[model samples]
Target: WLRAGGIQGRAILLDYASWATAHSIPLSPFTSQPIPLAHLRQLIAERSITIRRGDILLLRTGLDAALKRLAPAEQRAISTRSSPDFIGLEAGRATLRWVWEQGFSAVASDAPSFERGPVLGDHADAEHTLHQWLLAGWGMPIGELFDLEGLAEYCAAEGRWSCFFSSVPLKVPGGVASPPNAVAIL
Candidate 1:
């Protein structure tokens, strides 16, 4: 929908160090930490990433890679955890505002959901999830389970966070979701 709406633009990758640290721990895949707004701001500044209207934001949380390392049983167990958790953007007004203020056309991450799981018990707005706001309210497309390890490494080596990202989803009428056949070019 973003493409159809002419919302495509430069893509920026946010590579958090936690991804690497968590990958070294075998059981870390079962849980995720929250990416604070302050930390996000610092990362953007430190990486010299310039946010523009309609840009696509790709967050590298390493959840995909970590899950790949887990045993089948471990994966199944984590998948069914009550109130499952994973590292992602924190749930709050600040996060919602940050995303809106940035004017991103879409947001993608290596985590399962774009936002932290087991939604915060004290969140001001309990009725709506980030998914609801981003996808339903803002009409912003959200991508999850993206394999960004290679992209992150390349960006780090070249010190370039922005890229030309293109994705082609299966054209299925009435389809609610489809795999993201995506590519990123520096």
Candidate 2:
């Protein structure tokens, strides 16, 4: 990211929060809810998403909006957790296989991490990490904690999921990560 500056391309938003709620698929941003592959495929089919190579997958877990609604003290409690946890895509073989086969250029989410938090547990031990699978293995970029509430609404209102996405990352030479300034054009 530092060398290349940032990533930009056709981005697709899978508003799992809205879909799950409408379908009555229980989910919470605070707990460690692993979004199963079946739900994702179902979501794609329902939304008529045509998966394509080099597409950037932008997943909305509703974490950003959820945090905003919390009281200050409750928000602090979450931020200060020693074992930070949040809802995210499932971390396992099936999901990883699907991600790879889909040939996404990059993946991002409103959650803290693409795959569930507490990456050290089954996520790391099983060797199904986005860090390893997407970044190291497939050389795909990962995004997290993006403010996407407005984007979600715009997409819904526009009745589209795909967008022209771009990001401007701080040019900190040799830095590992930078907060991404991202935008999506419907």
Candidate 3:
């Protein structure tokens, strides 16, 4: 995957933070806020976005901005939690089905993981979550902890959410994961 020109595709941004703010919905990255499949469709319909095959789905859950505002102690607390929890895409059979049907090349998010963290006890159908299915089942790439706030700002200002996205992962043979040098061109 790293050797091959990497991943290049039409990327769509679902600005969940903006949607939640506009609707007076509360969200916290420290909590298990699952971005529902229905809500994703809602955003697509509301923005009149057309889904296409091989599209890279970018989801902004406001986690980047939220973490930026926290003090050092608060950040430390989150890092040191016994069973850390944070905002992420909802996990379940339904989520898996929708993602497969959409035919996304890969999924990326600003949260710590593409799917919710601490998947042991919190999520229903934890075994069928994205981390397991995307990585193990389909060999799909899942980008996490991406700094999407700047992208969000730019998109909001320009009223354009679609862009050309690319990323070349670190060239580590047989590596499970690697931080990517990802870029998006508006």
Candidate 4:
């Protein structure tokens, strides 16, 4: 249907870390899969493909698995804030630098924030460095927690490298990020 709407194309799809699979909830076997960051970087390098500025870079951390385990009240609390068990500052900085070097317009993850949670360590004590660098400095709007398993499967089978992406966000003003009701047709 989307292809009929002029959305078909070849593309390389990336699936980020999934908290559900990492935790072994078995909701989606593909979501549970892990594609190392280095491997992803290598793929781009091998292809000599540069991530253009304004391109979307999605990161899947599998945090949703943990998010699912929490009580509804706990989930609400974390919707705006991240737990301390998330990635750390050093890792976040390195990740941010990599994404910036690749010239991505935005960098996103399944976890709430780009940096690790406060509970995990003291490194992320600073107020969201990842946000400052990607959003304030680079003018990139990060997308979070997108469902990518289906899209990934399509790309893997067809060996495409790029596809048209479409999305619609809620009209709420001053929103930082909205849950993805987005898709890539290939």
TM-scores of all predicted structures: 0.85, 0.94, 0.95, 0.58
Rank the candidate models, highest lDDT first.
3, 2, 1, 4
Reference-based lDDT, residue 36, model 2:
79
At residue 78, candidate 3 shows an lDDT of 84
Q: Which stretches of candidate 3 lie over 4 Å from their true place?
A: none
- Candidate 2 per-residue lDDT over residues 1-186, each given as its tens digit: 446657888999999999999999887888877887899999999999998998999999988998999999999999888887888888777888899899898899999988887665844446676667788887788898888889899989988999999998888768767888888887
Predicted candidate 4 versus true structure: per-residue lDDT over 1-186, tens digit per residue:
222332222223444333334335343211213233565675555535446555666544446655677899976765555333453223455566676676654455555454444423444425436666666877766555656556555654765545667655554567555555566666
Q: lDDT (0-100) at residue 146 of candidate 1?
A: 89
Task: Estimate, for each residue in 110-144, the C-alpha lDDT of model 1 and write its tens digit.
Answer: 88888877555553257656887988898888998
Expressed as tens digits, the lDDT of each residue in 1-186 for candidate 3 is 567878998999999989888878899778877778888888888888888999999999998899989999988888899876888888999999999999998999998888777665746586687888988899888999889998999998998889999998887877777887999998
What is the Cα-based lDDT of residue 166 in candidate 3?
Answer: 93
Give the number of the best model, judged by lDDT.
Answer: 3
Kindly provide the TM-score of model 1 when superposed on the true structure, using C-alpha atoms: 0.85
Misplaced by over 4 Å in model 4 are 1-12, 16-39, 43-50, 63-84, 87-94, 118-120, 125-128
For every model shown, the clashing-pair count is 3, 0, 0, 20
